[model samples]
Target chain A: MAARKPIIGVMGPGRTEVHTEPVDKHVELALELGKQIAAHGWLLLTGGRNIGVMDAACRGAKSAGGTTIGILPGPDAMDISDAVDIPILTGLGSARDNINALSASVLVAVGMGPGTAAEVALALKARKPVVLLATNPEAEKFFSGLAPGLLHVAGDVEGAVTHVKGLLAAQQGGAAGGAEQQQQ
Target chain B: MAARKPIIGVMGPGRTEVHTEPVDKHVELALELGKQIAAHGWLLLTGGRNIGVMDAACRGAKSAGGTTIGILPGPDAMDISDAVDIPILTGLGSARDNINALSASVLVAVGMGPGTAAEVALALKARKPVVLLATNPEAEKFFSGLAPGLLHVAGDVEGAVTHVKGLLAAQQGGAAGGAEQQQQ
Candidate 1:
């Protein structure tokens, strides 16, 4: 049952609003991903705040009556967004590290900066499937040359979300196939 | 010249979506505030990202052709949304201190959680005008006991924006009056 609902962790800043571009597109894509995840009965984990893409994704999940989890750092000094259904305040030493380690079964990093790079590296070390959306080209150029296929790049939000969904489905199917063979 | 267009620091979380009790009310308020701020020719500073109220506010500011500044953290994260014209990455340091100690005319906090609380305290400590929207009950209780006119509370977005505009006007008038008295 737990395997059925794969957790999808989204990595980004928790308490800052960074809008270097039009946010509506990202907001739309995030909500769409949330809807798709809910439709597929998957869990959505994020840095929870009622602002930015985190809130947009949660709105999408809740609109579809899906369960969303927010890993918060503190209650008084820090917090998740208003859209979070479950707020887990872990007071972890490394804010991004804890969130990265707990985002989901497969991690998706969108619009990352310095803080999330270590999380991305951690995901790579863990051998977890990672999808990068609008990530730093320099970082990609550097990391891709270092280790090919460690990061999956997408052209846009649609491309990124679709690619991740496909990866998730394949993993689920492969796991089910193994279970069936064991039963036989 | 810098003082003429006083910087207004807007703080909130990134990547989270909002769903107010009545639905869309908070968003409407956030957008209205952005529009009002732009109309007043005030600079809008925020965490640049495409999500939640941040995006909405950016949209409003850009539509009005107002200058928007994104105070980003980290060296490689692309958290800036599309509407941002100027992007400043402040490395990995906590921006709370910088934002609170900002040379801004006023500080407006939208619907946010604990992260918003930290900024609110920072603004208060800096003796800046802080207007809080969608604040928690405990915060309201705390503010009520602070002083007679330290904080101004608004029920909705229009009220909040109007209240801030009024504050800005009064601040300008007081400064001008003081300048005249000094000359005499």
Candidate 2:
């Protein structure tokens, strides 16, 4: 289950067409984000596709020999990224976005699109912290307003990772405090 | 695995406090909606809690002698509704809402809240038709805008069931057309 280390969900937009694949700044950021997540000994969870941010992040994690879990939308490995170490075929379509949101202790979104936006919303609805990396200003503002302090806008990949760390630490601290209060 | 009949997810707000349980008009609508879904031989699914719309709908389904699946947030049956024939303990907290959204062939939300809003959003994002019985106007507008044709507003429980039937028929027709085109 790879529950040993904390899991960080890196969700973003994915393109199906090879020609439309924008290997731009966002893709670069996603790749670096995966490396940083792996370097910190955290598991990387993604949408598990062969193109766009999902593929780039998974490949980056694999390049560093880090574990990756890709929750695919379909119930097969037809479009799974080779870099994904564990591919879960849900057959639930985009609804699996909930699993991606809940499975991670903290979510780090590299870019914004309908898919990533849904994941971000689901994460926030579940009361999980989300670090948005270079997403558009509109999406940034919209999602941030949804859950207040649950949203963190990071300037870059490292900043996103840092936000992830801070958020996870805060959550753990809150959980511990709650446990203590319960005992009292 | 009750796949013989399509499953309809009935989601709405739930409260932990027994005294705060709102057995109001929305609860009545949800119960009637569940009965309508069962009368059509469709399976019903919910959050599987002891309070709120989830409990009311499941109880309604059981009164009609219909099978109900409850995807509980916790990993145990500590607060599961006795009316749920099958309980899926995900322990994913509110994240299980995604499964509720994905598992159902169609989603019928009788009221609106943060939890139900998330389910409605996820269902729309997945391109599934959702029938809103008596949700708020703001939620109705926001979710309807998210997916142009997927959001169906119904005035009452019977109207909601009618919308569900119409949407499912349209979906099947579209699928059939797509399959015919593929064959051609």
Candidate 3:
């Protein structure tokens, strides 16, 4: 029997709390990433927040009529995106980054920040592949050096989605991250 | 009533899976960090693994007759440290770093690695202070730049414990990470 639908985690910055303004490029990239993830018939996962990459991605996925699962930082539904169909509240605050990173078959980071970097690092630690989009060259270099095979730099959303598919296929072809595969 | 005893989480490389040989300095520092955390009348926390930093820290805490907790990556009691008084099986694999980062009053990273970097990043994302010991300068600079005042570079285990105490005091005095404070 086939395993459940692969959960693709989209991790990025939530500028509502950190930055005064939304990062337009990240929002744009994340929106496309969500659309691509949904178009592929994969499960889309993101942080259930009101603004920034999470909200934009959720919007894109919902626009495509795809189901989305959001991991909320607070216990109550404080600032969740309206598009999230399934909201998982951990009340773990920033530590909730772990849930976002661990739950995904592959994590696509559209932007770089303290939280997003943590998720990427955690995912790599579990031997999971992380596809980068719209992130700086410095971050790309640093993370790439840390995990040679697991880090993939993508030029755009389509490139990211392609790498995601390739990485997941690679995982299936080989017995990599035996414990991480059980996350779904 | 006052809050429960503060938990100091010790995070580092497991080494058994990733590396063949142990980094001696990290093991030595983590052992002392655990002892200092225990002696300060605070609780000790670590990954419930049999080798490397987790095991060494647990051993130090137990040696000092202190209460210790472990976050196990698997559901079953596999590769658990003998010194772990309370073992929480997460089955989260590398994502278990969130529990280690969030559950602590402060996290002391004895060494630098993919897993430890993620924990430090997660903790800082949640506005928790992290004390560093025996880590390379590049890792230190990277994390410090991300968190600013949240990062503390320690010369020794005793120094790390001091920073942990100071940071916790600052948290209580100020309203930093209000949501994170509710983690315990």
Q: Give the whole-model CA lDDT for all candidates, comma-separated.
A: 0.63, 0.81, 0.84
Shift of residue B70 alpha carbon in model 3, Å: 2.6
Give me the candidate number with maximum lDDT. Answer: 3
lDDT per residue for candidate 2 within B1-184, as digits (tens), equals 6436778899987853223535477778777877887888989999999888898898888889899999999988799988789999999776677788778889988776557767777777666788888876655655665566788898988888888888778767877687765464
lDDT of 3 by residue, A1-184 (tens): 9778889999898884323355488888888888888888998999989788998898888889889999998999988899899999888777677777778989999888788889899888877889989887767776887788889999988789889999888777765547665666
True contacts kept of 1: 0.00
lDDT by residue (A120-178, candidate 1, tens digit) is 55455445677776665654553354235656887676777787778877777877777
Q: Check candidate 3 and list the clashing pairs.
A: none
Question: Which scores better on TM-score, 1 or 3?
Answer: 3
Runs in model 1 lying further than 4 Å from the true structure: A1-184, B1-3, B18-25, B179-184
lDDT of 3 by residue, B1-184 (tens): 9878988899998884323355477887777778888898899989889878899898888889889999998988988998899999998777677778778988899887788889888888877888888887767767777778888998887788778888878877765547765676
Compose the digit string of candidate 1's lDDT tens values, residues B1-184: 3566867766554435543345354556666777777888888876666666666677678888788877665564566678778877666334422443355577777765434544554455445677777755555545434323657777776777777788888888988786765464
Ranking by DockQ: 3, 2, 1
Predicted candidate 2 versus true structure: per-residue lDDT over A8-84, tens digit per residue? 99988786332354557767887888888888888999999888889889888887879999999898879998889
Question: Estimated TM-score per prediction?
Answer: 0.45, 0.70, 0.79
User: Which candidate leads in TM-score?
Assistant: 3
Output the lDDT of residue A106, model 2: 94
Better of 1 and 2 by TM-score: 2
Candidates, ranked, lDDT: 3, 2, 1
**DockQ of all predictions against the true structure, Cα-based:** 0.01, 0.21, 0.47
